[model samples]
Target: MAFSADELRVLRRALALALHPAPLPADEVRECLQLAGSVDEAIREAGRLRAFLLADLARYRTALPGSATGYLELLQDALAAGYRPQPDDLASLRSLRHLPLAAALLARCQGIAERSVRARLARSTAGPSGAAVPAAPAPRTRLTALPGGRADIKPARPAVPGKPAPADDPAKDRPVPTPAEAFPPRKRPVPPGERREAS
Candidate 1:
């Protein structure tokens, strides 16, 4: 069924929810499927199929970028060739059949277009007043733990040249073992006292 722009948006949002597996309220579900009605079973089936497709798509993008690209190309071709969707077709389409088969296809395209427009607007506005806007930082993917099972962080700074750093903490600003406080002297047994000498 050819969906209007608004129907496309709702269907896309519902598909995104399903792909992500977020908790769907009863009212939300009712609202989502309201346009489908009881007769258009193809639309509902396509919606379910689209859910699985997008879920796999999300994973494929990260796991196999090249394969994901190939998948999209294949999906486009399949859609062009009358990709009639049969939802819950577990064997053939475990999580992917065609992208444009669902009513949300236009919405998917709109989302991408909207994102691009927003990105361009952000860049254009990034001059004097846009300083208040905070852009998402790029991902920094690296191993959390370093070699030898230690934290992956900067190395401890070496003591500056010529000035030996205190092995103990310098914060205390006092030596632990002062030379004045010496250990007890060895005990020596005195011979017969001077009284014996006077005798």
Candidate 2:
């Protein structure tokens, strides 16, 4: 947030270039790139620090019943940094309501915590009816070919009038056609000068 004098000058130059159509000098460009990298590092460091603070706040909240003074100090720091109180935190704060500061923070965070809870409830509940509908059953599965050039699917058709149904057979489940049925032999082409032989 508090940039060095050189960084501020470079930032101003970058902004000026943005407003006016002009190319940056080679050294200025390099400096800008270095500044961008530093900014990225700062962002990452801030995130790491936030995570650490949240973890510490949780620990302090757990220690509230046994260590009120320490917990209150940490909680204040956590609250100052925009920490949203959990239900557990609210309960802990309620127990320390005898202390004026604890009571005040509890009142402040209570509204936010309640709104958060309501929002969660609204999301989880169904439509205006508030009723849950059962999911439909899955469709029947189709048979697929096996690795060894096989499939277990039998074609069934309605019998013609006055005709008997086909007999059931276990092997019939997997239809296996003869080689001729699968592919009939093809006739060879005759030469232009050759005569055809009689059967």
* Best candidate according to TM-score: 2
- The digit string of per-residue lDDT tens for model 1 on 1-199 reads 6777877877888889878988888877887878557327866787787766656654543454346455454445434544432232222233343543432443444454566678879877685866635567757887566566565434556888899774534445865665556675676865678658878
Clashing pairs in 1: none
Supply candidate 1's per-residue lDDT for 1: 61
* Residue 199, candidate 1: alpha-carbon lDDT: 83
**TM-score of predicted model 2?**
0.54
Error of 2 at 98 (Å): 0.9
Model 2 clashes, total count: 0
Q: Report residue 102 deviation for candidate 1 (angstroms).
A: 22
Cα displacement (angstroms), candidate 1, residue 159, comes to 91
15-109, model 2: which lDDT tens digit per residue? 88889968778999999898888889988887788788888878877776778887888778777777778788889989999999899888988
User: What TM-score quantifies how close candidate 1 is to the native fold?
Assistant: 0.22
